[model samples]
Target: MRKTKWFTFRNFFHRSSLTSSMKPRPVNAYSFVPFSPVAMLDPTILTIGGVVLGIAIIERILERWGVIDLVDQFSKVMRFILPVTFYGALFYFFATFMF
Candidate 1:
Protein backbone atom coordinates (compact mmCIF):
# COMPACT_ATOMS: atom_id res chain seq x y z
CA MET A 1 0.00 0.00 0.00
CA ARG A 2 1.22 3.54 -0.90
CA LYS A 3 0.75 6.61 1.36
CA THR A 4 -0.90 9.68 -0.28
CA LYS A 5 0.86 13.15 -0.47
CA TRP A 6 -2.09 15.01 1.25
CA PHE A 7 -1.90 12.76 4.31
CA THR A 8 1.90 13.26 4.49
CA PHE A 9 1.58 17.12 4.21
CA ARG A 10 -1.29 17.33 6.72
CA ASN A 11 0.84 15.62 9.40
CA PHE A 12 3.65 18.23 9.02
CA PHE A 13 1.58 21.38 9.91
CA HIS A 14 -1.21 22.69 12.19
CA ARG A 15 -3.71 25.48 11.18
CA SER A 16 -4.69 28.45 13.40
CA SER A 17 -7.70 30.90 13.46
CA LEU A 18 -5.51 33.99 14.47
CA THR A 19 -4.89 35.22 10.87
CA SER A 20 -8.61 35.49 9.95
CA SER A 21 -9.49 37.38 13.18
CA MET A 22 -7.65 40.65 12.25
CA LYS A 23 -9.00 43.28 9.79
CA PRO A 24 -7.48 46.55 8.47
CA ARG A 25 -9.05 49.87 9.58
CA PRO A 26 -9.35 53.06 7.52
CA VAL A 27 -7.60 56.34 8.51
CA ASN A 28 -9.52 59.57 9.25
CA ALA A 29 -9.10 62.72 7.18
CA TYR A 30 -6.68 65.46 8.25
CA SER A 31 -8.30 68.35 10.14
CA PHE A 32 -5.94 71.17 9.13
CA VAL A 33 -5.04 72.92 5.87
CA PRO A 34 -1.59 72.53 4.25
CA PHE A 35 0.98 75.33 4.08
CA SER A 36 1.60 77.49 0.98
CA PRO A 37 5.19 78.29 -0.06
CA VAL A 38 4.25 81.37 -2.15
CA ALA A 39 3.63 83.66 0.83
CA MET A 40 7.09 83.17 2.36
CA LEU A 41 8.18 86.79 2.95
CA ASP A 42 6.07 87.58 6.00
CA PRO A 43 7.49 84.73 8.05
CA THR A 44 11.02 85.14 6.67
CA ILE A 45 11.17 88.86 7.53
CA LEU A 46 9.77 88.26 11.01
CA THR A 47 12.28 85.44 11.62
CA ILE A 48 15.30 87.49 10.44
CA GLY A 49 14.22 90.49 12.48
CA GLY A 50 13.78 88.34 15.59
CA VAL A 51 17.22 86.76 15.11
CA VAL A 52 18.94 90.16 14.65
CA LEU A 53 17.18 91.52 17.72
CA GLY A 54 18.21 88.50 19.78
CA ILE A 55 21.85 88.78 18.63
CA ALA A 56 21.88 92.48 19.51
CA ILE A 57 20.57 91.70 22.98
CA ILE A 58 23.18 89.00 23.53
CA GLU A 59 25.97 91.34 22.31
CA ARG A 60 24.83 94.01 24.75
CA ILE A 61 24.91 91.52 27.63
CA LEU A 62 28.36 90.29 26.60
CA GLU A 63 29.61 93.90 26.35
CA ARG A 64 28.36 94.55 29.91
CA TRP A 65 30.39 91.56 31.19
CA GLY A 66 33.56 93.05 29.58
CA VAL A 67 34.33 89.98 27.52
CA ILE A 68 36.64 90.01 24.48
CA ASP A 69 36.33 92.91 22.02
CA LEU A 70 36.02 90.48 19.09
CA VAL A 71 32.25 90.39 19.20
CA ASP A 72 31.96 94.18 18.74
CA GLN A 73 34.50 94.25 15.90
CA PHE A 74 32.86 91.25 14.19
CA SER A 75 29.43 92.88 14.53
CA LYS A 76 30.78 96.10 13.06
CA VAL A 77 32.31 94.28 10.10
CA MET A 78 29.21 92.12 9.62
CA ARG A 79 26.92 95.20 9.60
CA PHE A 80 28.62 96.33 6.39
CA ILE A 81 29.65 92.95 5.01
CA LEU A 82 26.67 90.58 5.41
CA PRO A 83 24.11 92.37 3.22
CA VAL A 84 26.61 92.88 0.42
CA THR A 85 27.76 89.27 0.60
CA PHE A 86 24.18 87.99 0.78
CA TYR A 87 23.00 90.08 -2.19
CA GLY A 88 26.10 89.23 -4.18
CA ALA A 89 25.64 85.52 -3.60
CA LEU A 90 21.95 85.74 -4.36
CA PHE A 91 22.56 87.61 -7.61
CA TYR A 92 25.34 85.27 -8.68
CA PHE A 93 23.30 82.15 -7.96
CA PHE A 94 20.20 83.44 -9.73
CA ALA A 95 22.12 84.88 -12.67
CA THR A 96 24.13 81.71 -13.17
CA PHE A 97 21.27 79.25 -12.74
CA MET A 98 18.06 81.14 -13.50
CA PHE A 99 18.97 83.29 -16.48
Candidate 2:
Protein backbone atom coordinates (compact mmCIF):
# COMPACT_ATOMS: atom_id res chain seq x y z
CA MET A 1 0.00 0.00 0.00
CA ARG A 2 1.19 3.56 -0.77
CA LYS A 3 1.30 6.21 1.96
CA THR A 4 -0.66 9.46 1.29
CA LYS A 5 0.57 12.98 2.19
CA TRP A 6 -1.89 15.35 3.98
CA PHE A 7 -0.60 18.59 2.33
CA THR A 8 -0.24 18.53 -1.47
CA PHE A 9 1.21 21.37 -3.67
CA ARG A 10 -2.29 22.57 -4.65
CA ASN A 11 -3.52 22.51 -1.03
CA PHE A 12 -0.43 24.42 0.18
CA PHE A 13 -0.91 27.19 -2.46
CA HIS A 14 -4.64 27.66 -1.86
CA ARG A 15 -5.84 30.82 -0.01
CA SER A 16 -7.84 30.48 3.25
CA SER A 17 -11.46 31.76 3.59
CA LEU A 18 -10.32 34.95 5.51
CA THR A 19 -7.94 36.34 2.80
CA SER A 20 -10.43 35.74 -0.12
CA SER A 21 -12.91 38.23 1.43
CA MET A 22 -10.28 41.08 1.74
CA LYS A 23 -9.53 41.56 -1.98
CA PRO A 24 -8.45 45.04 -3.17
CA ARG A 25 -10.98 47.35 -4.87
CA PRO A 26 -10.32 49.48 -7.96
CA VAL A 27 -9.71 53.22 -7.33
CA ASN A 28 -10.06 56.35 -9.52
CA ALA A 29 -7.08 58.76 -9.54
CA TYR A 30 -9.19 61.97 -9.41
CA SER A 31 -11.24 60.93 -6.38
CA PHE A 32 -10.20 63.91 -4.24
CA VAL A 33 -10.69 67.70 -4.64
CA PRO A 34 -8.91 69.67 -7.41
CA PHE A 35 -5.37 70.98 -7.04
CA SER A 36 -4.49 74.51 -5.78
CA PRO A 37 -1.03 75.97 -6.52
CA VAL A 38 -1.02 78.35 -3.54
CA ALA A 39 -1.86 75.53 -1.13
CA MET A 40 1.09 73.48 -2.46
CA LEU A 41 3.52 76.40 -2.31
CA ASP A 42 2.60 77.48 1.22
CA PRO A 43 4.48 74.59 2.92
CA THR A 44 7.50 74.95 0.59
CA ILE A 45 7.73 78.71 1.25
CA LEU A 46 7.50 78.22 5.02
CA THR A 47 10.19 75.48 4.94
CA ILE A 48 12.65 77.68 2.97
CA GLY A 49 12.00 80.62 5.31
CA GLY A 50 12.58 78.42 8.37
CA VAL A 51 15.90 77.13 6.97
CA VAL A 52 17.13 80.66 6.19
CA LEU A 53 16.11 81.88 9.63
CA GLY A 54 17.88 78.94 11.30
CA ILE A 55 21.10 79.58 9.37
CA ALA A 56 21.04 83.25 10.36
CA ILE A 57 20.46 82.40 14.04
CA ILE A 58 23.33 79.86 14.02
CA GLU A 59 25.67 82.40 12.37
CA ARG A 60 24.77 84.95 15.04
CA ILE A 61 25.54 82.43 17.81
CA LEU A 62 28.91 81.52 16.25
CA GLU A 63 29.84 85.20 15.95
CA ARG A 64 28.95 85.81 19.61
CA TRP A 65 31.39 83.00 20.57
CA GLY A 66 34.21 84.70 18.52
CA VAL A 67 34.25 82.23 15.59
CA ILE A 68 34.61 84.94 12.95
CA ASP A 69 38.04 83.67 11.84
CA LEU A 70 36.72 80.10 11.57
CA VAL A 71 33.69 81.31 9.63
CA ASP A 72 35.97 83.25 7.24
CA GLN A 73 38.14 80.13 6.71
CA PHE A 74 35.04 78.05 5.96
CA SER A 75 33.82 80.69 3.51
CA LYS A 76 37.17 80.59 1.70
CA VAL A 77 36.97 76.78 1.37
CA MET A 78 33.35 76.96 0.19
CA ARG A 79 34.27 79.58 -2.46
CA PHE A 80 36.54 77.03 -4.17
CA ILE A 81 34.49 73.86 -3.48
CA LEU A 82 31.18 75.35 -4.58
CA PRO A 83 32.38 76.37 -8.02
CA VAL A 84 34.16 73.05 -8.65
CA THR A 85 31.04 71.09 -7.54
CA PHE A 86 28.77 73.25 -9.66
CA TYR A 87 30.92 72.84 -12.78
CA GLY A 88 31.34 69.08 -12.25
CA ALA A 89 27.55 68.65 -11.87
CA LEU A 90 26.91 70.81 -14.93
CA PHE A 91 29.42 68.79 -16.99
CA TYR A 92 27.77 65.50 -16.00
CA PHE A 93 24.29 66.91 -16.77
CA PHE A 94 25.35 68.10 -20.22
CA ALA A 95 27.20 64.84 -20.87
CA THR A 96 23.98 62.92 -20.13
CA PHE A 97 22.13 64.93 -22.80
CA MET A 98 24.94 64.41 -25.33
CA PHE A 99 25.29 60.67 -24.74
Please report the candidate that would top TM-score against the real structure: 1
The candidate maximizing lDDT is 1
lDDT of 2 by residue, 1-99 (tens): 967757677877783645453569898776364445444345544565565566557666877899999767656765686567656655654454321
Question: Considering summed lDDT, which 10 consecutive residues are worst modelled in model 1?
Answer: 90-99
Clashing pairs in 1: none
Candidate 2 regions with alpha-carbon error over 4 angstroms: 1-66
What does each candidate score in C-alpha RMSD?
14.5, 16.3
TM-scores, one per candidate:
0.36, 0.34
Model 2 TM-score (2 dp): 0.34
Lowest summed lDDT over 10 consecutive residues: which window, candidate 2? Answer: 90-99
Model 1 segments beyond 4 Å from truth?
Answer: 1-41, 81-99
